[model samples]
Target: MPPQRPAPSARFTPPSRVRAAAFGLLGTVALVAFGLRIGDVAFVDEYAYISQSYYADLFLTGEWNDPAWLDFPGYDLMPLPKYLIGTALRVSNEPRPGPAAARMWYANTHSTFGTPRTLTSARVPSILVGGLGCLALAAIGAMAFDFRVGIAAGVLLMLNPLYALHAHRAMSEAPCEAFLMASLALALAAWRRSFAGRASGFRILGLLAGAGVAAALAVLAKFNGLLALMTIAAWAGLAWAIPRGAGWGWLWFATGSALAAVTAGLAFMALNPYMTARDPVYRVADPADAGPLRPGPLGAWGRFRLLIDHRRAMSAGQQRIFPHNALKRLPERAKVVAVQGFGRFGPFGPATSDSTIRYDMRQDRGAFAWLPLCLGAMGYAMAYGRMQSRRREPPAAWAVAAWALVSLTVVTLYLPMAWDRYLLPIQAPFSLLAAAAIVGAWDALARLAGWKPRLEPS
Candidate 1:
């Protein structure tokens, strides 16, 4: 070695390592913020918690087959959240009053509701899941783009008022977001591994299977779980189509995807027996009770059929809240999406204003709204520019853009009612996109200023 090449700066730290540290700190801050007042009494949507009590009581009594439990509104629509609550209650040996001769006696008798006196058991899972969502966002960003992008995305997500507020609440959205992001990240990672020349069959299978399980858990958390499958499919489709010629890799990926689907089905049925099992032994409601109840010695498929019908009815009923014409509704929907994405602009912003004065005042002025908006637009533009210039775009960008576009389109078309909470699925992708923008903009600025970048582009 040339003696003049004196010890190339051993003290210089890798940019990736620096970014990882920043991300870890951001995640920690998010965890603490989410955990704050987790067990505090919920003022709004208390009914959701109360509804969970019914399912928990049934599970505690070993009476999951009871059709009577199906009487609750939206019961057939989603059952995974409550099933999870039951598991948590049983494992912790919380004070469940069900299975006692009188149902709802202990719950109604005590103001705190049945099972755990503190709301900790009910709320902790959501808080933990919310924290996991933040990390998953980072992983997706890092794996798809770079470590710096991941860290920036995570910090932005934590700073989001709507996301942060809902994270600690005993609600399904937080957990849904967590499962959704985890599934997407795992699926993307699996595909990347498979594309590598040295990828092992076992490794690919494991990644695919893990993704399937996460997908199932996501669905259990909320009906929107199905969207994860769609996102992964779009990613795979884009990957295959963008390349010049079909390769053996496509066949392998498709086979793995089929296996993942089967695994997802098994996981879904295992966690939620009511969707498949015909065991009338646990009489959730009397079989004789009339109305739309279908008579049965039902098949495994019967529950799903009933669920479909119920969802259809619910959807039709919800149309009253939205404009009859989709065209007329598009502007309002777009406004909501923009406000939610970039954040509220000023004091008493329309998007941030709410019934709760304190909450409204705090959220009306969003944190670094313009910066994220500017960076995100630039990032996407750069991505497209690269593709146009004959550079193979990063697969992660395609995956994230597809997720955001598909999710936005579906919600705008099918979801008649407009509520901010309904848009939770977009949070991760939005944060990631913004982070991409920031990083992309920084690189452009560096190039313009003729400064050397420490970390080369991945």
Candidate 2:
């Protein structure tokens, strides 16, 4: 006899309830993990933002910017949070508001706390975002495959100390990643509904709008978000092309996508006024500085140059270049002098650890722990083959696979500089793929071993 199947009611239990419970547990775990890092207070970028907050206040109070603050060339990449914190401090008007307020406030109040803001508060946003990101990953997995996959992905993400470390710091990466995952999840959900022939016009519009807002926020959080947007767009186009007929679905998809693009563009324009005022000559030097760069065509070269220029401009303000005379013998020293680029060479040899766990502990590390990742990659290949053979894959799965591949290729080819934080945003999807492979491999092994399958009442 064929294997007995579970009851319909068993499969019909509300997925939303399961997701909420899983998210609650994941959030609790993340909070506990973050609390352990609460004493860490050595972030390098904290002081810089504090200074920016003070200047922003000066601009607000009419003490600076005789020209309108909007006209100033300053690039305050930080969005509402930074300014809101500063405004809060100004409103409190405490004689000595404290470091938290000082960092958030317009004035220097570091001395009052006798310490900087506790790591907990400084890192609260990261922790929250990271936790949400984990939940989002789980949701994506559940939507794509099943609850098992979602739970497994969420657990893996929660345990990944590299993510945990970043989440406990006052950085934008965690939040950006969270938004990216959330946007992707929403898009996938909508796509699934559309595929099932249940999509309403308003629902589709809302998905696109949410995606646009998320993508824009991701860009505002960090420039890497453009990669996420491009990935989604390519997936959408492929979906449109492969369908049997050019129906109203494609029309709705196109309209929604166009609106999303417009929204992202407007957000970029609103936040990056510098793009408008920037001299064309200065902007032309680096292709990465213009907008987003994709790998496909030579046309992307212009955008790559703009990206490079943006990096150069930002790094110039952050780093102090050594005099060329100090490195007379180095062959490429002239290039460094000309472009003000600094090279980092280490005597300790190459970093080769998986995840940022070791890096957070001040140890040398690489992108991820190599062995598990390699195994995971192999597993993904197997899963891909299985899905192809069975024809059971969802459209979003293909999109995610393509996104991961393209993003990885671009980052590897164009930006060889490996920073642990750079990998955070992609970690969610990567982890899910990895987990899928692992689960698939285990199932295969169980079958090979002739293990009896668990039976559920019909």
TM-score per prediction, in order, is 0.78, 0.67
The residue ranges of model 1 lying beyond 4 angstroms of the native Cα positions read 1-24, 39-46, 54-74, 87-93, 97-117, 197-202, 244-247, 281-296, 318-335, 339-394, 456-458
Residue 375 C-alpha lDDT in model 2: 41
Worst lDDT run of 10 residues, candidate 2, spans: 340-349
lDDT for position 343 in model 1: 50
Assess candidate 2 and give its lDDT.
Answer: 0.52
**Candidate that would win on TM-score:** 1
lDDT of 1 by residue, 335-372 (tens): 55555334542212343335222223254345356435
lDDT (tens digit, per residue) of candidate 2 on 212-304: 777777775666677757766776775576443223554566667777777876765554333333232221212422223221222223433
Q: What overall lDDT goes with each candidate model? A: 0.61, 0.52
- Spell out the clash pairs found in candidate 1: 66-282, 66-283, 66-284, 67-283, 67-284, 67-285, 68-284, 68-285, 375-437
